[model samples]
Target: MRMKKVSFLLIALVVAAVGFFIGCSPAKEPEKMETVRVAEVTRSIFYAPQYVAIEKGFFEEEGITVDLKTTWGGDKTMTNLLSNSADIALVGSETSIYVEAQGAKDRVINFAQLTQTDGTFLVARKKPEFFAWEQLKGSTFLGQRKGGMPQMAGEFTLKKHGIDPHKDLNLIQNIDFANLPSAFASGSGDYVQLFEPQASLFEKEGMGHIVASFGKESGKLPYTTFMTKESYIKNNNETLERFTKAIYKGQLFVDTHSAEEIAKIIAPYFDDTPEELIATVVDRYKSQNSFATNPLLDKEEWENLQAVMKSAGELPQTVDYSILVNTDLATKAMK
Candidate 1:
């Protein structure tokens, strides 16, 4: 598409401008690096704080070498934590609810939360004069799998606007995340919920136009968080504290820096996307306060996430937030 081509051109220009300057800059090295395996659900701009920490040597400065894995979905990322393949997982806070539902003996606990609101934005194939939640009635929408926050957020946004998610729209759930763009291009659905880079990428291709940011209707909901098993957090307090400290620094760096600057720093992770588009995506997130300033979990927002899931029957029993999240490490990191 013409728009996608333009996006690629813009990235080329930005890369040419900053690539040389950054490549020549010295990368800070740590005297000793302690590798920590962290499983991330997705490599998205919404998770920019972690990416910023990785790119800007914040982790290295904390004497941590990060082994970041992209599991592509929250369930798998949580499994990484459950199986001990990963030391920690950066996942949707809603994941904690699902894990609690399973009643594992060594339950995973969240010590830090990064995204306080849903990062998903709605994209429609054709732009219309009036883009409203009610407009989705009678339309087919490409939604994420059940239990994932993206889909749950979409459902919440619909209900808040007086549209019943079950009765108002024909929702599709079988599409793989990586195939969403192609699926959209083929007209499988009229609307799709996506995080940054994917949403920005589709917009660049002129395949779809952003209709609504679900965050507006969903309000402040706990989106993504960092979690480890109770035993791991208990045994590796120092390491976990250092990780939070570095991520906290990353949050501050993103807040103080321009979107373009932050984009450049994390550009390597988004190499597939045009730098210009990635910067645009970062600007959107910056405006939304998508990342948290500190890792400490917000009680009210976490409750909202649980409420959303319980509304959908994804959670049967009430979950106590205190048991699932701890603030001491993040508190110490802040101090």
Candidate 2:
């Protein structure tokens, strides 16, 4: 009887051990995801892939969550990044150069460039008379007003061609972008400097012709970039790398996807633009096949711009090229 009882106890102990082992054995837990906050200076069809990445969960798939913010222009965008309100700003090289000149090294730095080619154009009246740049010498240019991008861009273009903008051209200021299409349709101003989609609008209105393409003159003006604060890049290096990789992926997507698809992705931001118009613009971009993050700033171009800015009395002193752009993090991400 004693032997039988011992045997029964041993069986029970073995059964308990098996149950404990089965219950406590490690089971795989779901992977923890990382989140990244980001921002953009403006909303345009140009930045469609970023919206697509967020909408399609590409960032999430890469273990990140991106919170994107948009501002009015470069100045406001810089403010957001400096104040820690944003982690990135898609801004012009001109703006980056100005910021770095001020020695805000802790808060400001450029990562990778977004577009190599300048997408700027001067739209003029539709007539044989307005076909050439020389004819545009004395024309009234509808600009963003004094100290605005259009005015400066116009001066750059004019001066590059050895035409005196101040004496030879009339640049009107404070023109609203939303009203530019109708303004041009009414022939309010003889010419206007426009970026994509809006440039397409001028073409569609049958009122304007592109007298000059900025890309034709400037090899690479550094139109837009991925900017970040030094502190963020330092503390969250891994996060930055993942974010940059996601952005490159976004660039690839932008290159492949159709305009209609892009328009659909960015529909939330551009409430006023018709889908048809967006489709037209995207198709145009496809034809151009212009997409890049190459931060190569030509030395001669920089010197030429500096000379122009100096002649226009825009720069107080010569800005160092090295301080103006940041390509390290972006290069790493691409690799």
Candidate 3:
């Protein structure tokens, strides 16, 4: 009887010791996530891939939490990046060239291309039965900011059609970027150049008619891209690679999915805009091949962009494409 009692006591002591050790042991911690602050020039259906990446959890899958903010304009977006308020910037590639021209200490580098073509449409108060470029002559044209990518591409297309933007039309560009749509709705110009959702919404509300796509007319160029400071790339190479992987995944999703499917995924980003309008804008952009299929910024497209800038007399100096662009991360992300 004593032996049985001793054995039971020994067993109970062993069980208690195991339980104490198990209880005292540290618990497994949750995985740490890195947050990347992104400053985008504007929020529109034009940047559908970015939205798709965020909405579909591509960034999260890569252990990244995106903090997206619209800085309203390219200048503002770059300002946020330069001041360290943003880890990455989604703006026109021209902004990086502009910063390089100014000789920034931490030069902005174009890492990934998002939009390969201009994302603007020429909207007129009245739609002609058969629209012609010649009809823009002698009319009041509301262009974008003087040296912006939209205005540069618009002028490039205008010159291609043999219409001198400065001489053939009464051009107005003094309005702020945010006020352009309202200014047009308030009866400001005979015609205006607008981005998506706004362009489609204008048509839906009978405020304006889309006469032509500057994107289709201007040909392919690296219009909008993702950029970051040189130091950021050097210090956070791994993180940037993960970010690029997420971006490439987003680009692939946009490439494979239908406009309606994309619209459904990205609707949360543009909460106010109707899903139908978003889909319409997405279809319009997709039909023109405005959205880039990949994140690689092509050398040919970069040169074409500089050509447009030069045509607009906005090229400070021809900054070497090698100096301003880094495709290493994008290439690695593809694999």
Per-model TM-score versus the true fold: 0.88, 0.80, 0.92
Cα miss at 197, model 2 (Å)? 1.9
Per-residue lDDT of model 1, residues 138-225, tens digit only: 9998887787787887787788889887888898888887787778878789899877777877877788899889876687876889
Per-residue lDDT tens digits of candidate 3, residues 299-319? Answer: 999999999999999999998
> Can you rank all candidates by TM-score, best first?
3, 1, 2
Q: Flag regions of model 2 displaced more than 4 Å.
A: 1-29, 105-107, 145-150, 176-182, 257-261, 293-312
For residues 23-127, write the lDDT of model 2, one tens digit per residue: 999987867887565667678676665676677777887798777777877788888878878777777656665766676667466666566555667777765
In model 3, the runs with Cα more than 4 Å from the true position are: 1-27
Model 3 TM-score, 2 decimals: 0.92
Root-mean-square deviation of every model = 16.5, 4.4, 3.1
Which is the winner by TM-score between candidate 1 and candidate 2? Answer: 1
Question: How many backbone clashes does every candidate have?
Answer: 0, 2, 0
The CA lDDT at 280 in model 1 is 97
Cα lDDT for residue 15, candidate 3? 100
Tell me the lDDT of candidate 1: 0.85
